[model samples]
Target: MQNEGEWEAVRLLSTAARLVRREVDNRLRELGLTQERVTVLRVLAGDGPMKRAELARRLRVTAQTLGTSLVTMTRQGLVGELPPAAEGGARRVVDISEHGRRMLGRADEIEQVGFSADIRPELRRELVSLIHDLEVHRAGASASL
Candidate 1:
C-alpha cells in the first residue's frame, strides 16, 4: 500500500540506522563495550538501580537476552547485582558500578565526536521528532492489540 517514495524512505532510514550502529559498535569495541551495553549503562546511570525485569522491559529486549549481557557485564565488573530489597523477592536489582560510569562517560564523548559531527543540527532534530512520533504511534497500536 506504500508508494515508491515511501519504500525508499524506509530503506534509507533502515540503512542509515544500521550504518550508525555499526560505526558506534566498532568504536566501542576498543573499550570492550557494545552499543547495547552502553545503553544499559546509560539507563542505569539515569534511572538508578532497577530490577532486571524492569530493565529488560525498558530496553525492549527479552529477559534472557538482557541476562546474557548482564552476565558478561557482571564478570567484567561493569555492573553489580544487589540483594533483594525485601526477603523472598523474586526480582534482582542491577546497578552500574563506578567503572561503568567512567566507561559511560567515555562512550558519551566518543559518540559525540563520532556520531554528532556527521548529522546537521536541523536534520538531527527532524529525525528525532520523526522517530518520536513513530514510537508514539507504535505504542498506541500495541496498546490497542
Candidate 2:
C-alpha cells in the first residue's frame, strides 16, 4: 500500500549499515578499536570529561552497557576515571586518555579510507537529511545528535 517502497528502503539501509560496520570493524580490529569504542572516544573528546551516567545518557546507551565497555577500555588505558570522592564527590567521571586520543586519530584515518566511496553531493545531503529526519521522527525532540 502506502509503505511499499518504504520497507525496502529501510531494509536496504539496514543491510548496508551492517555490511559497512562489518567491514569497518575488521579494519579497526587491527588497531584495537571498534566503531562503538571510537564513538565513545569521539564524544568524550568533544564534550570533555563527564560523569559515567551523563556519558551513558549522551551516548544513548545504558549505564550497564557502558560499564562493560569502560572495563575493557580502562584496562586498555584508553580511558581514565576520576573517582566521585576525588572530584565533586558525586559520580565517577570519564575522560579519554592520551592514548585514546592518539588511537582515535588513527581510527579516523582508517575510517576515512573505508568510507572513501564518492557519493554525489546531493546523495550525501539526502543521506544526512534522511538520518536527521529519522532520528527526530523516532525519538521526538530528544534526538539532538
Candidate 3:
C-alpha cells in the first residue's frame, strides 16, 4: 500500500501533466503544429542539425517512432534530410525548413500569450522552480538506476 503523501504526489503529477499537455497541444494545433512535430522542431532548434537517431535520443523517443515522424514531416516539407554528419550508414542530417521556422515562431507566440494571460506570474515562477527541482531529482534517480 502506498502512503498518502506518495499517492497524492503521483495523482497530482498525472493530472497536472495531462492538463498541461492538452493545453499546449491545443495551442500548437491552432498554429498548424502537432505536439509530436512541435517536439521534433524544438529538439532540432536546440541541438542544431541532427540525424534521426540523435533526434530520437533528445526527444526520448524510439528511432522507429522518430523515423515515422520524420517521414511525415519530410513529406510535409517541414524538414529536409541532408548529408550525414558522422560515419557509418547515411548521415541523414535533418534541418527545419523555412516554413517550419515560421510555424514554430507562431506556436511559440501562442504559448507565450497563453502563459502570460492564463497563468499568474507567481504561479509561473513556482511552476518553473518545481520543474527545476523535478529535473534535479530525475537526474539523481536516473543515476541510481
Candidate 4:
C-alpha cells in the first residue's frame, strides 16, 4: 500500500538505525560493554534505581532477556540488586554501581569522539523529532491492532 518513496524512506531509516547501533556497539566494545548494557547502565544512572520489570519495559526488551543481561552485569559488578522494601513487595530493584558510573563515563568519552560528534545540532534535533514521531505512530498502530 505504500508508495516507492515511502518504502525507500523506511529502508533508509532501518539501515541508518542498524549502522548507528553497529558503530556504537563497536565503540562500547572497546570498554568491555555492549550498546545494550551501556544503555541499561545509562538509564539506571540517570533515572536512579528501578524495578527489573519496569527497566525491561523502558529498554523495550522482555524480562527474560533483561534477566540474562543482568546476570552478567551483576557478576561483573556493574549493577547491584537492592533488597525489596518490606512494603513494596518482593520485586527486586536494580541500580548502577560506582563501577557502572565509571564505565558510563568512559562510554561518554567514546561517544564524544564517535560518529555522533559529526552530526550537526539542528540535524540531530530533526532526526530525534522524526524518530519520536515514528515511535508514537507505531505505538498507536500496534494498540489499534
Each candidate's lDDT (Cα)?
0.91, 0.87, 0.80, 0.89
What is the TM-score ranking, best to worst? 4, 1, 2, 3
- How many residue pairs clash in model 1? 0
Compose the digit string of candidate 2's lDDT tens values, residues 92-126.
78999999999999998887788524456898798
Report the backbone clash tally of model 4.
Answer: 0
lDDT tens digits, residue span 48-139, model 4: 99999999999999999999999999998999998888886656899999999999999989888987677889989999899799899999
Give the number of the best model, judged by TM-score.
4
Judge candidate 2 against the unseen true structure and give its global Cα lDDT, from 0 to 1: 0.87
**Which candidate number maximizes lDDT?**
1
By lDDT: ranked, best first: 1, 4, 2, 3
TM-score of each predicted structure versus truth: 0.82, 0.80, 0.70, 0.83
lDDT of 1 by residue, 1-145 (tens): 7654757777978878898999988999999999999999999999999999999999989999999999999988899988875667655899999999999999998998896468998999999899899999999999999
Mark the regions of model 2 whose C-alpha exceeds 4 Å error after superposition.
1-7, 85-87, 116-121, 140-145
Per-residue error at 143 for model 1, in Å?
4.3
Cα RMSD (Å) per model? 3.6, 4.7, 4.7, 3.8
lDDT of 3 by residue, 1-145 (tens): 8664766766977876678778788877766678789878877777788777878987888999999988888887888888754556467789898888877777778777764357778987988898789889999999998
